[model samples]
Target: MTEGRPLRADARRNRERVLAAAREAFAAEGISVPLDEIARRAGVGPGTVYRHFPTKEALFHAAIVDNIERLTDYARELATAADPVHAFFGFLDHWVAEGAVKRDLAEAIGSDHALELSSPVKGMLDSIETLLHRAQRSGGVRPDIDLDDLLRALKGTFLVTHIPTITDAQRRRTFAIVFDGLRVR
Candidate 1:
């Protein structure tokens, strides 16, 4: 889609289907899931998957960008919600939950490919920052905190979620601690 002027309606639909399938497949089965399996899951021919994403790295990069774009959009919506504090904390909850699932895909793609994701990651961080500022203005979040600090804490939380056998209660407690620290006491 990025190579052309624009994708036609049917072509756009095909690409989206492929991406949705790829995201689920990669997240569930890792990048080792064959393109043929992705196409089968998408209900499209294998050639269609290649047409949209020529290589595994290309497809993975697209999938990761697509996920970030979606989260950014969601965060932007929540930023203007009636309860800024809830929106901020709720976004963090959603983000961490998503990271727990997506960790496999990121690991399968390897650290080398992750370096190309700066742009979309920046957009995600900016959306979080907007929500943070809104929450702070509402006197729910700590005024002294900044996006950098929040990002560091979020990264650490994501890492914690990578623990091989962490129970759900442990995960919740970990997040509760982070949330408690960020909230204005």
Candidate 2:
């Protein structure tokens, strides 16, 4: 019932508020935060939140999709940078830093239902791959590294080092070590 038609101005405002509140709540409290609490935080009723998102998983998926879209846009913009290798690793560092607070959404990205979401996840991946190829062609990155290899290393590092207990300095150190391994020998 909530699909197909365009939302009225007030309804659109409420939906944005719900998403912002949900992102904050999920970041601070994990994905287990209650819908009613999110509604309260958003200054809207629970029914309003449900009307827009349908279910908690749907809301979480939407949030992840939003994050991915932002990252994709960032990568696209970085593609035009003068130094291809700097742009590529800069995007990776930016992503890892942002993931410190938004780590809760990472699991949802890898979830079975992620593909069903509306976000352009594939486009984001393609952007990264393009960056990697550019860096490889310029001899700034190792010849053997591919998109999958970079993704695995980056995701693995973030998953292991982005914990609440880890200091920002520690995260930076870990990222530096990881990036060192990716650089051309």
Candidate 3:
């Protein structure tokens, strides 16, 4: 170990703790949450939190990336599920839920030059393509549909379905309508 330059294990722990707390704080309270409150939540000094994150946007980027990775994993799981239809709907539900979190993170992460669309977005799109292909082959989704149009429609659904006050039931209804329209006769 480099005695003079190395951060101790305890110091490293504090850094991670601060990031975790900041994520929670930002999720609950947005980017305007006090650094002092975040430090208190982490059981660290404000300086330590500041040292780890430097800016609120930097902390938000960490949280956003973490969340995107989780969503990506879920997409991978859904892509390989036993029932292709169930997997597709499960992916949609997960997308909506994650989109809510992304909605908040986007306000900060969108403004930061550091943030970019993660590869999972592309992976998820490809997964959706595979699912749609399978469903179409099985006479589930309509054969006449263009994949790009389908993707655009689903993205439109994401935007429409993002309202905070909308119940899951409402989302289900909306999803059903969308699914019904896209299904083969």
Top TM-score model: 2
Instruction: Supply the global lDDT for candidate 2.
Output: 0.80
lDDT of 2 by residue, 87-165 (tens): 9899887887777777754554434554434447777788888888888888899989777787678767767775668
Tens digit of per-residue lDDT, candidate 1, span 52-133: 9989867877777767787889998898899999999999888777777786323422234652456776677788889999
lDDT of 1: 0.80
Residue 105 CA error for candidate 2 (Å)?
5.9
- Tell me each candidate's RMSD, in Å, in order: 4.7, 2.8, 5.2
Which is better, 2 or 3, measured by lDDT?
Answer: 2
lDDT of 3 by residue, 1-185 (tens): 23478678988899789878877877655666788998999999988877767787667667666765665677677766777766766766666565555554334322334543545445545666777776667776788886677756765665566577877778778877987887777
Task: Report clash pairs, candidate 3.
Answer: none
Q: Which one is best on lDDT? A: 2
Give candidate 2 regions above 4 Å deviation.
8-10, 29-34, 104-112, 115-119
Model 3 CA deviation exceeding 4 Å by range: 1-6, 29-37, 81-83, 97-114, 118-168, 171-185
Candidate 1, run of 10 with poorest lDDT = 104-113
The CA lDDT of each predicted structure is 0.80, 0.80, 0.67
Better of 1 and 2 by lDDT: 2
TM-score of each: 0.66, 0.80, 0.58
